[model samples]
Target chain A: MKQLFVLDDKKRTSPIKVLLNVLLVCILLVAVFWLSLSAINVTFDFSFLGNFQVRIWQGFLMTVFLSLASLILSLIVGVLSAVGQNSKILFFRYLCNIYVGFIRGTPLIMQIYLFFYIVGTAWGIENRFIAGVIILSVFEGAYIAEIIRGSLLSIDDSQLEAAKAVGFTKMQTTRYVILPQLVARTLPALTGQFASIIKDSSLLSMIAVIELTQTMREISATTFKLFECYLFLGILYLCLTLPISFISKRLEGAFNYEN
Target chain B: MKIEFYGLVKQFDDDRVILKSIDFCDDIHTLAIIGPSGGGKSTLLRIIGGLILPTAGEIYVDGEKVSADENELQKYRKNIGYVFQQGGLFRHMTAIENITVPLIKVHGYSKEQAEERAGELLGRFGLLEEGHKRPAALSGGQQQRVAIARAIAAKPKMLLLDEPTSALDPEYTTEVLDIIHELKQQGIDFIIVTHEMGFARHACDKVAFLCDGQLMEYGESSRLFNQPETEQFRTFLGKLLEWNV
Candidate 1:
């Protein structure tokens, strides 16, 4: 089977070799941190983490929930938008193009601010969590739409012709022929997008969403352990993102249809 | 079943004509359309199968006029089976699933019924053991056989083939032609667009010669092959015959 990760293993690193390299890096990092602490005359203490552990855990849970909800909404929006973009009707195609253009061209932070300050205010929505999800979904949805459109278009034209020639209705063709192939082709990209979504959830801190980053900010301010709080936040993000990356790699391997 | 094409004209960008004012009718069970490359043979077949809309033309299948409406076209298409130059089998589906999908999904056959029918078709094509293999895993010949099996699974009134064996090696070509011949013996109507002049002569009841987006000749296979009237057809057949030799 072809390897999915595309990493060249011609210069194969042995397990012991990799372990030694990791240990060397870890030692170097530790040395640098120790020197920095000494230079600042600050004692490195992680005891402050325990004081705000529950609050941080709550924030972590909130981030996960927000990401999950936004992921689902974004996928729905992406699919609908992709279909709209690829629609035979000129107006629908242009409409989707403009939407993807506007969302993608603007900064995510700006879009979030616009949604929170303008759209949310106009709609009289006071729930910050809901607003955060909406913002993330719309922002991520644009990227997902482009990913889906690219993936769908990448499929050979003959596939659709075959489906139609086989007497499948347009919807049936999409449901049976297009969607299955589309899902397989788009999954790796979707997983990458999902990891981005999880990391970008940190941006919700600006809106007082009390997510992981927000919690880290509060902890750092109260306990005066900015470095430790930020480090923990970075580790938390890796915890969220690495599994998605690993699973997507595995899925790419499994769905390697060509091979 | 009878099929007719009246004043069929397919043009692109208002000037590039692919098929120009083709008027032909045939009631034969197997009609072979032979032409040079880019001669509009496949385009005519596609137009006849309702896969492509003619820029200007009317098609009648078994006395029923084909329409542009999606529902009507789908209904019309259900009665016709089309096999592409490439097998065009779904890459994700196994041969059995490829054959059975339309049976279960379009014809509303029960899963068991669809599978049984698929098994029977695969068995008939000497591909029973290969049913679980996807298109990429199958040989070129095996893929074409599965494609034909899938096309015929619904027992369509007419089968349209667009250069069905064009992509195959000689061995696979012979294999596919043999299957097509067998299917014809079973009284399945076919309109095959092919470069296989020998097969067209031997297997087809009628033959149409198209060139430069025009129907040069249309008549019984024996007459058209033996005594082609037009200079263009003679030149086309001369090249084909020289190539075959």
Candidate 2:
């Protein structure tokens, strides 16, 4: 007989075990949260939710809009940069490298402040919402480019050699072979990146863009309900991200057969 | 086919020369390049196929110079088929699509024309029933056959086989080799890099023995195998053939 602690394929999961584990986890989380709340001598009051309902909904919509816009623009930027890194022109290749390096190396908060105040001002980008979308796209595009470029690089050299051997032009190879692979390999990560873009858009609050966090910030500042506002803000963001994360996971499972 | 090289060289680094001062002018059909591991056989074949450029020198097939420029090389590569050891079929494509995509995209065949040609080749290779399957779904031997079908889909002037059966077992190796022999019988001229000494001796018209980045011997296959010129090649043959049953 195998030891009790050993993992065995024959030892299948049971419904009761699953239910018990989930219940225990929920109880542990609530117990810890309750103990912390009592220790801090904090009493929650969510009555201000009635007054700021409209503003909160508007903020949520703005966050959604900002995320959607950023996701698309960043996807374009990501694909271009990923392809650029493989360019024959040294200038184009280095430009992609430096762009990805600068964005990934720096903190997002610093990027928001720098791009919004300095670069946006210099470029005469006066609209905060547009500036926020552009800033978020630029920030997230670097990470997406890395995700795409990694998949691009992981494609075997032999695949390319075979394409060349068959007389494919650069454009034809990209169309027939490389693009299909890039899509199959990067779809899950790109969907997951949408969730990250939504979360990252919250940083635009620093520049007074009325995304979810900014609206919550104003309400909490006025009503003196900081904990309640932030807690509700987290829940609101989760509502937006949870479905996207679930889709990303499903895509990951679906694409596992390509290998 | 006549393969002529003028001072051919390939260097990956300052000192890491893969092919060093290769000088050969040969007029032969059905050539096989046999060499020790890492002896630059595949690199030489790739250079000839225009898949890669040599550091310095030129390859002349039928007295026509193969350009080293990436853009110009495409014109040369289109006329030559290359089979890699791993089959190198596009992982996402079915066996038939692997053949047809190149025909339609590179050769400008209509979809019907490409598919018809691909179906004929797959049938000839005895893969008609399996043509709809992806490369991953096929066995190693089947994948290599699909790769071969993909290679010759557009009727390349000459085919380059780079250790095409190295990854297969004895049975699958025979299946791939049998198809290759049938291709030769159909007058599809080819140059192969292989370790099958018996196949190289019996099937090929010319044999070039490469070792340590140099062509150690080159001659008619039967004569060279029986009477290798270099002392090094003789010792090499002894070690290779000693345990053969």
Candidate 3:
């Protein structure tokens, strides 16, 4: 017989980690606050948020419009790529494979530069917003395509066969039975992709699209308050990303608890 | 309705033949095909369900030569409900949603009508309470029942069940068999591929013993069970009954 020692009557639970994590967060917040204050003089002015609010708000709107436009294009590309990959036809399968590889193999930033400078300029399109949206769509579409493909493959083969057995044509089966399940399964990935799109909107600054971070960069250059501007920008980015994160988590929880 | 398999042969490459010129006919409500493993029983069922084509022969459904025409085959398949060995439930849909799917997608029933029909079937299977549960949340037996309910919710003219109870516990086996027996009584034609001799003897109207991709023995359940005509069937029966003993 083996003898074991039980030190405590109760097992240690999440309490310590919760306390430590909160403390760590507070410490990080203090350090960031201290650095921000030390880097620039503290001035409480509501004018930037009010006087320049229109420009900032316009940039915010532009960011949202760019993200939405890119999302729509990416949705079409992603769905098509996923379907092509799942197609029984060899040509379509190979085509989708090549598209995924070509997009994912290259860095998004390089692609952005290429689209903005080479492609858009060559086409005589001066709008940076158009270039930004197109680049982001192509970049994110590849990732979204993979997510959709995985979800489609994750579906049971028997379900497809069952649909066929019921006299559903291939198109009908794909449209009705397969697509709904795919959408539900890929919901989280879509939310994640949307969050990435929000952060990636900051990259539009390079293209002079004057989105959130660009607005901050411009104001900070004139005001000489890089810390204050960035902190505000960080808070704004968090505002944008946090809701999407919350919705994704809620969707995941609902899906899991549905059964 | 009559289903005919005429000299059906399925060969892989030039050497191996899974089903060799197999000929069978059935107009009965319930036809059970019993055989040892790898006897091509499932291949036969798949061919009848139009899931797979016979490489050499033609299959006629209800006096219509339907196999060659792809479009006609699609229409013919509307009347069949195939329950694979695994429950093959969506795993994502609630039990009721899975059951209502065929009605909504293929039969063109409205969502409300589909749910109503599905609710009735779930109630019949004693799964009304479990209707909102996913397949993963349910026990194996419950999942199997949900699969069967989904199959029949389409009100298919025929049902093909492939070794449905093989993966189930004994208690659950009885539950499924009881449901099948009830379905048979309600005049739902069934083509069952089962290893359960007890279900074949008690529930199935007729039994066909297949071996080596051939129907070696087929007759009324009594004759096939008590006095199997061939030595191969006798060996198969002896091995199968040995487990029961």
Q: Give the top-scoring candidate (DockQ).
A: 1
Query: lDDT of model 2 at residue B32?
Result: 95
Better of 2 and 3 by DockQ: 2
**Hey, what RMSD does candidate 3 come out at?**
4.6
DockQ of 1: 0.67
DockQ, candidate 3, comes to 0.52
Which pairs of residues have clashing backbones in candidate 3? Answer: none
Native contacts present in each candidate (fraction): 0.64, 0.79, 0.60
lDDT of 2: 0.90
Write down the lDDT of every candidate, Cα atoms only: 0.90, 0.90, 0.82
Model 1, B1-245: lDDT tens per residue?
Answer: 88888998999876889998988776879999998888998888888898888899898888888898888888788878889999489998999999888888888999999999999999999999999998988999999999999999989999999999999999899999999999999999998999888899999999988899999889899988889899999888788767564
What DockQ, on C-alphas, does every prediction get?
0.67, 0.63, 0.52
lDDT of 3 by residue, B172-207 (tens): 888988999999999999989998888888788789
Cα displacement (angstroms), candidate 1, residue A80, comes to 3.4
Most TM-score-accurate candidate: 1
Docking class of 1: medium
TM values, all candidates: 0.90, 0.88, 0.87
Task: Count steric clashes of candidate 2.
Answer: 0
Off by over 4 Å in 1: A1-43, A87-95, B243-245
What is the descending lDDT order? 2, 1, 3
Q: Report the poorest 10 consecutive residues by lDDT, candidate 3 chain A.
A: A1-10
